[model samples]
Target: MAKPFKNLRDKMSPQAQNASEEKAKKMLSEMPLQELRKARQLSQKNIAEVLSTEQANISRLEQRTDMYISTLRSYIEAMGGQLDIIARFPDGEVHISQFKEIESLQNSKSAQSSG
Candidate 1:
């Protein structure tokens, strides 16, 4: 018998949840730079400043579906958020950190980096 769509997956087996998490991670991992920047509620200029990159460069990076690690980190930091790539075993639990801890991640990056 088919169950109604009441998010019955709440009781989903661990294997199912792992697959769901993996899919979510894959999608987020490949998110375009612009979308990520916007999700952080930041403008192109702001992101460029943090990355020490030019506006044109930021635009270019965002257009691509994949980016360098440093570039990804910069964008994540610019949005006052941290990007955590987690690998969970079938039985393992995921622990997400508080946003406050992520806010100051790039404090060491100089503000003058942008021109």
Candidate 2:
């Protein structure tokens, strides 16, 4: 009684198929932090352990709409991902390098403090 989705999709025009694929790609590209974490197969406890914080803190951080860049960077790093700050313009997009520099500085400071 039910048709397979792949068979239905095959009946679509090439343009329609391409549009559907593009929409799916867009959906996969953007997601909230909570969804991203789950997609990466990580739990709040896992991130907390890597970040040296409590699980409650990780939960609170994921719910906030606003947070410091360093805080966000640390959270993303704990999940084994690098955070990139991108500035989109009418002409093109630019990747902001200042945050990368900040991360390097923090790493150096941490190394010095530990050693």
Top-TM-score candidate index: 2
Compared with the true structure, model 1 gives a TM-score of 0.46
> Which residue pairs in candidate 1 have backbone atoms (N, alpha carbon, C) closer than 3 angstroms, thus clashing?
none
lDDT (Cα, tens digit) per residue for candidate 2, span 7-86: 99999999999999999999989999999999999999999999989999999999999999999999988889888899
Give one digit per residue, the lDDT tens place, for model 1 in 10-94: 7888898889889988988676657677756789888788878898887887777776655666677777876675557799966
Count the clashes in each prediction: 0, 0
- What would the TM-scores of all predictions be? 0.46, 0.85
Best by lDDT: 2
Q: Model 2 RMSD to the real structure?
A: 1.9
Alpha-carbon RMSD, each predicted model: 9.1, 1.9
